[model samples]
Target: MGADREGGARRRPMRAVACAAWGILLLAGCASMPDSGDLRDVESTPRQDTEVRVFAMPPRENAPPAEIVQGFLEALTSDDPQYATARQYLTPTASRRWRPESSTTVLADGWDIEVDRATAHEDSGDYAFTLTGSKVARVDEQQSYTPLDGRYSQSVHLARDKSGQWRIDTPPQGVLMGRSDFQRNYMPVNKYYFASDTAGGTGRPATAVADPVYVRQRVDAMTRVVRSVISGPTRWLDRVVRSSFPTGTALRRDVTALAPDDQNRLTVPLNEKASRVGSERCWEMAAQVLFTVQNLTPTVETVALQRADGSTLCTLGADRARTVATRGPVKRPEYLYFLDDKRRLVRILGGTAGTSVEPVPGGLGEGLQRLSSAAVAWDERTAAGVSNDRKDLYVGSLVQGGTLGNAVLRSDGKTEDDRLTAPSWDARGDLWVADRDPARPRLVVLEQGKGRPVEVTVPGLDGRVDAVRVAADGVRVALLVQHKDGTESLLVGRIERDGRSGERTAVSVLGLRPAAPDMEDVTAMSWAGDSRLVVAGREQGGVQTMRYVQVDGSTPDVPAPAALTGVKSIAASDDERLPLVAYSEADGLVRMSSVAQWQKVVKEGAAPVYPG
Candidate 1:
């Protein structure tokens, strides 16, 4: 090679080259290497003396306390027709919770926000403050703000982004309403507790059977609830009753008690004379505790959650359900009830049922697997209820999978009208179920339970919900709601608590462009990175994908129509991660950073479409 190099054009000798690349992460003032991507730098201890606590200042002192207080009032009232505020100061995340489909929930003017003092306790780029004010609903005490009427002092938790501007973690969770009872209140022995079943509609209603509210109350309140920690599984109930209860104003000697030892038995009986059915409680998913007997078939039972304890919590009785059912061939012996944490009954679901009933499991697959397979056959016979009283109504929950999460698909009735639309969950963890009704339309939020689902309400947008999405944190949610008179859109809101009431705030509304006419609804929405949402489902194999950043209703900054080329399933990556799109038609999964990068993945080969 040396001789050849003398005559021919010799290539330069390739040397062993070791390349080194370094990244620097800057925090405070010092720079250090971090694992990568938007994780807010985690730095090692400093070499010298500096106290972070000393520098911490409350929200009002560091910045104008007035602006912080005003911003919240403005955002809160933005939805009110009387107090329509502009959308300038909202951050992208804040705007997501501020989407309003209907009117914004407001605190009537009678409630004055006279900020007594804003003491900035601490600041680490993020801010925290303690706020006190006198908030009163209108003296008239109407439905608008009837529940909250009084003065209160509350802790205000706020956060600041890289921009150094402070914002509330959520105005809803921190706000306090004195009049409302539970959902927040709890202690050693308090009558008030969290409630669920409200105004019926959890399942079917109970017949005119005696209400168990009094009985369950006696159980939770009169019975001394001893700690299971010292003992195990609740055996302590016997000891607690023998030693602590029985004397003074405690339990009456005449009344019989549920033996602690009875818990081990498959079926334990409650004293019919002493115990009554409690109101039934429902969750957003599946849940039902049977009220067939005063005694529950040995299972761990607690009082159902309600708005507040001691307050009138309505639960459905199984027999009541048959009477209320729009269709009948009413069967009794129904079994199901929701009890409060105090072991008081909340509601009755399916009463002691006839032989036709079956136990509903928590997971989707477990439910479907339980079917005898004959339920599908149109043929009727004398076998396992397949012929006449089919199990379809009870089975098709479209439940979330056991661990990974999946949905059960079942129709309530033999006819098509009774079948539930396929249930699904979006990028944000909020549950999205297809609507069955057109006019008084309803899309139920199913909370998982051992027996039946607990239906919870999403305020602001009611019924006709085309799609709903919970944020990465199941706490925040967005919805694609359908309206009468032919209107549809993206409605974003967050769950806030005013004392006991579950309040929702509408942050923004998404308007579909006529240019993309064929797209009927925004079936899937993923908040890619910060301000952009990668909207899917416009055309068929046509796979229309668009990214939108909201500025206002008039002008949302959208990239060129072709920003995303032939996109399919899209997933927004978390901090330090690149958003991914599944173009199954081309490859399978395509990774990208921004609009430009996503365009590159599409240009190379399109991903296949996800099953609609």
Candidate 2:
């Protein structure tokens, strides 16, 4: 019965849990619960009653648990040194998920990791038994918080080594970058996360942990940052360029023409702004993103190219400018900081840098930010790209595997339920899809055909499967599942190539609760570089977060712990390498470890390194 019932819904929903109130008193009823501190291993567990018979507390206003987890995970590989490696965890897209300006003060001063533990309790169907973690804890007085309105509501970050064991890694090595064994995982529709709260005293009045004055001050400061970053968006578009037309060149009647003069002209600002103290020379090309996705109405953000030098090539967005998308563009970039010769940000932008996020009624910091939560992928083989000979960026939504490639953008249907998610390309160029089908959500196989779609199913995924990853070799598949109750589980299964429903051979369990918080479902996932799978979760509220989870190895420890969880929605590459989007609290994304501490912990752990 245990096997047949799939844990009998023993676990609750794996959706992202936002501990917006860190001051959660552990819920008084928790006293009757097991003592996780006892280390008695009573088997950590969350209730499974789908029915809401128990109210954990006064039901204070709070962020979902998923948000907290996602924030923490992104915080792990927080070092700029971890960027390249971490980028692999991101899907290939052209949208930003971070606010460079917000991170400038953060990443510029990166964290050193110190992991305490990275393991899941159990996996019952999609529900995970227990997934808890701890860190060395920080004492950043300026950043530290107390309680707000009798409750604890502070920006949260965790410190843990998803690497499991410790080891030294190059930028690329930080993630599963350039792994020869893995396949190139891709998703077209870029996902993003937003941290700005629309929760203006919504629902019931919630409590805060930080002193109301301090919290208000911090919020006001962030508000100023937001205002500063966005002010340039409109001004840059109007004053910077139009006012910089060369001398008297007859300005095209089509483009807004303003003659450049000492009075109103602008320069790269050869000031000490981003100049290094002692560097002899600096190369500055694409000083500004010629045009941003918001200009063209981007579904996701593919921003930034961190150079070998400490300096980074990033997109700079301004909110004051016209939000110019197809219908209406958004006016924010996830991260706001940029690196100078000294690896410091001279200017910071605002907006999400994620690849799978939906622009929720967002715009110029005010308007519905539209997102094409498609989660599709293209490679050297698909039409989504220019050619195998060219470097082209294509964005697509998830389509049923059966309808994959066959239709450039065709999904079974865009009804309330049939939306594409986690679309990936296989070696054979066929599309293997993880159907979000509520009735019978199975792995749908889609190949290029002439007239109509020929649908097939994978018997292995007969129940609630969240996300699926096909190994680089195309012989294996990793499954991220969320049982009905809200638990999480991971399983690696062998894929049979028979014409009939492929047979599945279970290898070993990777993690039971890899994507908690946003565990309701995994919206985006891919093989990052070699040894890891970049996975993203869809929160119960429809938002998702990204995760760089470890893949199985030759040993008992198959699926390892998740890097981040608990956010609205996110997307990542397989090995946790390429980052279409970095983590940001403003976007509701989580960073388990603080940038400074995560780097430190991994070093101390001298942890075992996984091979690509």
Candidate 3:
């Protein structure tokens, strides 16, 4: 929300080959070499200008029923004011009753539009066609989108008018479009909600979760974003987060626009039903609005809630709204921690003036050996690691006099790829891991550093999990899975824990769903912000690219840094504003700071990571 801009000018090709690579990431094999020599001198391909919203062409006169239907569907994707041209294809009564803004179903490319002429009667002057395609996302009545399965079929009915001109008789209420049209016509916007609860240990206030949804790029986007937040969280995340807006909340009558005042404080008018709530509830709702608006438009620094008469109910500033919802560990250390050349854990203080890196003054740093990948607990007292051989998984103390313990979990040492993935720590101090060992391919959740590992049941999980990352809330686990066909994808599942009070002894995964279903060949992933992740992998069969994707699989329009080609690993703070750190073949260990430029942070470093 700071200087970070979403959806810059990065352009994806309109060709089928380009989309095919992005849709499933069908890679023949992984690339072993770097793609770019100088990260600073590289320039991304220029994007085509897609800002022109209104279409120049209108419905042709005396068009047949099929052509009229086609013209209407295409016209719906334009930015024409009031859709005056599109309405010409519909009967007067149908046009009056139809609302294109009701909902939107985003479909995949290459959909077949078939007109059924088999049943047509010569005298009836009526025709029907079918639209069939795989869906990517569905924007519902309130405009909240859920990224679940998108296989859809809709029938369009057209009839001739009294004047003998073809017009839509029973057009669907909402709109539908293919992915390419969606990309060029719509834009992704995030609606803010609160985390389910405060951070467990430190009592940090609940943080805001940004739910990414798409809306018309130039048409009433602000209105759509606000309305969706008021409606509630999307279907996929309803159980994971909370919203302050009341159940029956709505915008006040006669208020059709949202604009910032000269002072940059945006005033929002809610219906009288919302004004009936108590002051505390009102403030919370105000925080939700403040956070949501600020993300969409950065110039808004404050938010004022008001009623129909325009009398301000409450005024909230940006500073207080920023920390309303927290994610990740309760207490993040001042330094970014990673494994050093000596095979020990080290820290590089964040925001420190000079670039001096130092190792932890403890047994964990001195006693550990042959370390390849490591993760520090939120408390910063415990550390977990996998041996360079990927055979052993260990958890130990990070303090001065503490000992480096032996492996709590081990993998089949048959091959390097069969070894365990680097461990992940949850807010409850639970350690999570997955073994690619085909003989024992399974996910385990260990209680801190002791007890038997609990095997999580993943229903319909078609492949072996390669890496696992648990969210700070301890309810979600992000996994990178390799399918039977050798293609990889990023999936997130709910960790079903058993225990309301005391220590939880049982854990399992349910509803395993792909976080980025369309993206394949996912190599690395880490929690970047609340309900968001920075994924590193190739959408195409080439060098890996990095982008910040929503946990629900929706990618924001914001411009992410250029792809760190040949990147082996990457790490980021739960707070989005913090600099991102990563290890790559080209740069060794590098960091992106305030200027958002990548620079070397350490000459010899590997497996960089952050706390839970």
Q: Candidate 2: where are CA atoms >4 Å away?
A: 1-371, 374-378, 381-418, 449-456, 460-462, 484-488, 499-525, 535-548, 553-577, 580-585, 588-612
- Candidate 1 lowest-lDDT run of ten: 376-385
The digit string of per-residue lDDT tens for model 1 on 86-105 reads 22233446545643322212
lDDT by residue for model 2 over 226-269, one digit each (tens)?
12221222210121111111122221223221122343221112
Predicted model with the maximum lDDT? 3
Assess the local accuracy of residue 72 in candidate 2 as a C-alpha lDDT between 0 and 100. Answer: 28
lDDT for each of the candidates?
0.29, 0.27, 0.70
Ranking by TM-score: 3, 2, 1
Cand. 2 TM to true fold: 0.28
Candidate number of the best TM-score: 3
For candidate 1, what is the TM-score? 0.27
